[model samples]
Target: MSSRPAPPSPPRPISVAELDLDAPDGNVLSLRPAPGGPAVVAGDVYALVRLRGRPAATVIGTVAAGEDPAEVLGALARERLVAAGPRGDAERLAARSRPVSAGPPPRTSVVVATRERPEQLARALDSLLVQDHPDFEIVVVDNAPRTTGTRDLVTRKYADRVRYVREDTPGLAVAHNAGLAAADGPVLAFTDDDVIADPHWLTALTAPFTADPGLGCVTGLILPARLATPAQILLESHGGFAKGFAPRLYDPAEPPADEPLFPFTAGSFGSGANMAFRTEALRKAGGFDPATGTGTPAKGGDDLYAFVAVLSAGFRLRYTAEALVWHHHRDTWQDLRNQAYGYGAGLTAYLTATLVRSPRLLPALLTRLPRGLAYARAMTAQRGEPADGGVPGEHGTHHHPWPRSLSRLERRGMLYGPIGYAKARVTARRHGRNPR
Candidate 1:
């Protein structure tokens, strides 16, 4: 007997169009799809359009089954739902037309936490000195440095514009605490040595705090410095530091729905590279956890922990896409793999710490654990694959499978995170006793 014919292969996803809703001339968009190619479903395809370099809209279209993705996108453009043009044109237009704040910007204390990357530190310092916001100071903290090279460099090159401090502690949290202690401004902004702040970074970051005294934390957009390498592209495709272009306010009173982990999905809040805090609120929340960041066993989740702490303390957290910074990603595949592992380990450690510190949240954490695991697995499986129709902008056509070995390594790290965190706690206690 002849076997039934193999099931027909699934249709390949298509790259439809890029829309610019904030463009100067008008809303403009462009579509590129091969004729007679795969049919696209309207619900499955969408564009992540930006306004003034900030995530503004996630535009999804409704196309009939078996219809051309390009035609549907074009029709949407005509309806003025989205403008036709290249990806960043709208952002540029918004930048030019955007109005300045009426009053003087607040005094912001910019902190740069550095270890051994002196060259990168120099670039970061340079960016800070030229910020459009006038009333700000740069605080450079050299964390557990083997030598005084960073301090010396800062003294020689930026003595007039920057305040340099040295924290002998190795952990990122320790360095942050040191910076916080030294900062004089009411608003403290933190960026890594590997980041270059936009000229308006300070202005944008501090504005929300001035407008709302209740806001405790603010995170900005982090775009890639360059996407010329494979690793960089893959990292952004997997999920970059950018939260979106639109401004968002997260009030504890009005918690988001369907987030099983409420605030614990730390990565969603923002990256450590471009975040700011109200000095009073951060200090009251106890600053960063010494055991949770880089240079410690946890290897990452300090930023996440801080976000949760700020929210738990009854203060608002705002994500302002306009406060922009460019981050230099790890260019090598090995470094990227190591980063992935750190992320997994960090997340697990953060969860463990949450349970230990606040047992009341344990029930909520437990309720969310299974769903979290399922989401993690789903993300791993869909790492490089595009949706059935397509993803808008660069993500639509771009696909890169995360190496299986790397994915496994990250999973292994997640398994080890709790143990790592425990060890780190023990070490921290020992250090506390020794006073070294």
Candidate 2:
């Protein structure tokens, strides 16, 4: 039997809270639980500050045992949010009040891919069923199940509200592809089984498609569902999955000046946890690459591959912070270590998949290779003095340094990416599916 040493003791847990700056009263804000998280408590708190129901910023605050958490967090939120100035709040409210178009939002199919985590799946499904979207359907893709837990849950609990599909193949891409095959609506949105989506998520995600005929993909903001653990705090402190509050449209016709790598800088585009696609565009681009993503030797990259694929097909990608989902991050150091390896592996594997599947993009990738390499170094480098170079952190910028050990694991994953991808491709072939 093999013995693995346990990690050191973790830090004090920080409770996750949601602070709406636009609460009925000015400073009389009530700190609420993050979706799927516990109630507000006096200790360290990580809050998602929303101004007028829009995610304004995330700020950290502390409250003594005797002090009220809401009061403490409210003061911190007001002070920090004020720093954003009055114009910012006005614009956010304006944007919210502004309509996308005269017509209704597109009909949508939301895909929730899962495996053995029935509890998480159920929580995610409950959130999805309550979406404010005018028209939508939920499809639960049970990926490579070890038992019928997911099937039973969907059939018994969400029979009428949610549709259930199963993929015997284990890979995340394969599972998503299964959902992709079953998706009926013109617009398809994909979120993980561990998420608690905002009520307006589906509406916000699909609205762009109806408003912008040329847009192919839409991705949204992802905030930590829970920050009650050190690993989660560490990850969120480094940006977690939340992209900034700024809405961006990446039109291949004209790349942004800030991104020299353009479409290839897909990670910055958005994450898989909160992404949607124009059904026809994704189908035309060949759906997701089965050789990538979790559950495969590739560790990850399924989402990244699809992002690049859709973009390369000459369609634009939009990112709106308005469409949000709360994600439950891995809570332990080992999980973090695994994530680091997966992230690194998935990056390279997706890059490899992109080139192999769409050979023409190889030239563009080659031209940007040098700069990409430089960026990778900066990303895996230490924190600040060395940083992950990930999305800007809460309230803006990081609070903790990236660990050198995790960085090394990530680098090793990058090295194994191509090999792992190749292995996954072979596995797919043996299983009677097309990996390419």
Candidate 3:
């Protein structure tokens, strides 16, 4: 045995390339080793190697060979692949490797507002049921359904786990309110039918609330489910749902300064698809506006309105990037165009409603109008340009071009928004539905 020493192990392969971590629409690049690569896992350390005249490459600390390549890359990236430095390298590695302790997580009620998409709802439920967080319940609000399909599916497949409710009212806000009424948990979370949440989503979302009793709302990050189609890429280029990769806390005492649009630009706070709120705080804000949202005349802006209300009521809101969700984008070109139109209409309507409800804020809003218009023009001009090469960056400012017709449609929607909002208000009044 001593005469014939064992042969040395083969050297592991190192992969060095620029990772486009932040594509315009929140899509990460798909990088994988050629074949027979090393295994990659979460909490693995990597060094950023910089060479002259070349993009930086990641010197992988672990070879995650023969596994799902995309999964490995994503895990490494999320764990923050950073360059080695003089400051406390050992401590960082230990912190990353430490297992998260399990404790009694707060009970949360997750609301899924769906209209006609049973297939997508099913997929969303599948992901929700398997969440690693222990204490949670699912409330599926079938909003103005033409058929009993969603109810029947939920009863048959998830009766033990999910509570199915039929909200005859036709609006995302209405459906959300219905869910709020039905939920029993102290914390209520909302997500769309088209998103698949990460296993740690609930834990990440609720942790901030526990740490700060005054925290009223928490919004998570939304990444694209896939980027195989052109429309998906374009939508992402136009600034996807991701606010930013960094965690942010908005203290009511120290509101953001120098922003042209403060509360009116509430969409920047976070998206509706992956947001949670304290039940009592949301009720105090009067729930979501029934005149807004997908099924209403305003076509959207309910989430933005809610954000503004929460902030105006003097509660803190936070954006936690770790609470992740993958949203399936509209696959067709026409759908994408319609979505763009909806966004403009929704935003304008949100501002209009704000002015109607709170006249005192008008002075500030007027001051911001010129700057807002300028920003909109800049956005229009940046359309169709190539995105910044997959480098990690801020969200909500990227501009990808839609067809000329689509752009025109969005502008038209913006012009019509105030009128539409007026009509919606009248309709809501008629129905005795005033979602403040």
Candidate 4:
């Protein structure tokens, strides 16, 4: 007879916290509760370790029932943080992380697209209000909102500081375009309504554009704001937005050797939540496709499409670790399931949109399609020992073992992507709108 398989472990709650390795006490931990969540208590803990105010690493530990959450998490964080780097290195990074080549960062407009999530929007707005960058304006794009909550919050509380624009269209890309059209700054930065930005985020993100005039786009780091639930922890374990801690430049003129897919692998550059673009460059390439994003049949690929469009336009793209945000990931298991499928759908949808937008790149994409499909298979396969040996990822993605179910969902979504994009295009045409 065949041996019986082991049952899966029961799901448990986890607490989230932040620790600064360079703090005066060097052991103080700031515990942050998830949105609408209860207070932190002793249990599994997830902490974002910072050195000199810059995110360095993340560590997961357990706080026994009777143990103090702070002390337990702080000690584990300190040990792992040391492995990240010594204090001197943190100091140097801090010293060098100034306004790059600056008289001052260029005047920029920050765009936040949302749909009826008032409380979360408030948190993000609060953080944005404190950004250290000197000249910047905030624009909130209400995307097919069902209620006036977003408008009321922006008007009642932040009437003076933020500009409100309404995009009746349902897609995230459409809302972004509405904000882009309303913005007056030379640099346009886009972020979601579910993030807490660092004080220097704008400066670090926009400064590169000034330092390198040829640069058309820049993306920054996104760390989890909370890992309070099983879904959040599991997602972060395999690198939620894991783009390494180092800075890089993606120039179309000089494609990277390691990336076999080059610009087609645009998702590798960075995520949309922490990306900025030059106003002229984005307009020239045409803003995000209206049919591709959340709330559309495409289900998401707007950001990926934009990244490739910028690169294909012969502009350089930069990825900076210095600019950072804390993203509040979806909390429930069901939400994770939806996200997995949606990600799969979005990726292929973005590829479809890319080909539709510029047919010239189809040949290059076709050449890589075979390898790309194989790579996708491996990515969605059940996670066991990592392909990169058994070493833990410095970016904190290897903490929890992954389930094959989520992988399967992503693959299913990939299969449906091209079909979804077709439906979305058909709908757009029926509505007498050109998504391009």
**Candidate number of the best lDDT:** 2
Candidate ranking under TM-score, highest first, comes to 2, 4, 1, 3
Evaluate residue 113 in candidate 1 and report its C-alpha lDDT on the 0 to 100 scale.
Answer: 90
Q: Where in model 3 is the C-alpha error above 4 Å?
A: 1-104, 258-260, 383-405
Cα-based TM-score, every candidate:
0.77, 0.91, 0.76, 0.87
Q: Across residues 26-49, which tens digit of lDDT does each residue of candidate 2 receive?
A: 553446888767778778777777
Cand. 4 Cα-lDDT? 0.80
Of the two candidates 3 and 4, the one with more favorable lDDT, higher being better, is: 4
Model 2 global lDDT (CA atoms, 0 to 1): 0.82
Clash pairs, candidate 4, are: 237-397
Model 2 TM-score (2 dp): 0.91
TM-score of 1: 0.77
Tens digits of per-residue lDDT for model 4 on 1-436? 9988665553465666665655522655465553334566777666665655665556677787788776776776665544456877645544543335656789999999999899999999998999999999999999988999999999999989999999887888888888999999999999999998878899889988887888899999887777656677677766687575667999999999999988888778999899999998898889888879898899999999999998888889999888888899998889988998998999999999999999999999999999898878877785333221111222222224676778888999999999999998887677655876
The order of the candidates by lDDT, greatest first, is: 2, 4, 1, 3
- Which residue pairs of candidate 3 clash? 25-236, 37-65, 38-63, 38-64, 38-65, 39-63, 39-64, 39-65, 40-64, 384-401
Alpha carbon lDDT of each predicted model: 0.70, 0.82, 0.69, 0.80
* Candidate achieving the largest TM-score: 2
Total clashing pairs for each candidate: 11, 3, 10, 1
Model 3 weakest 10-residue run by lDDT: 47-56
The deviation in Å at residue 356 for candidate 2 is: 0.3
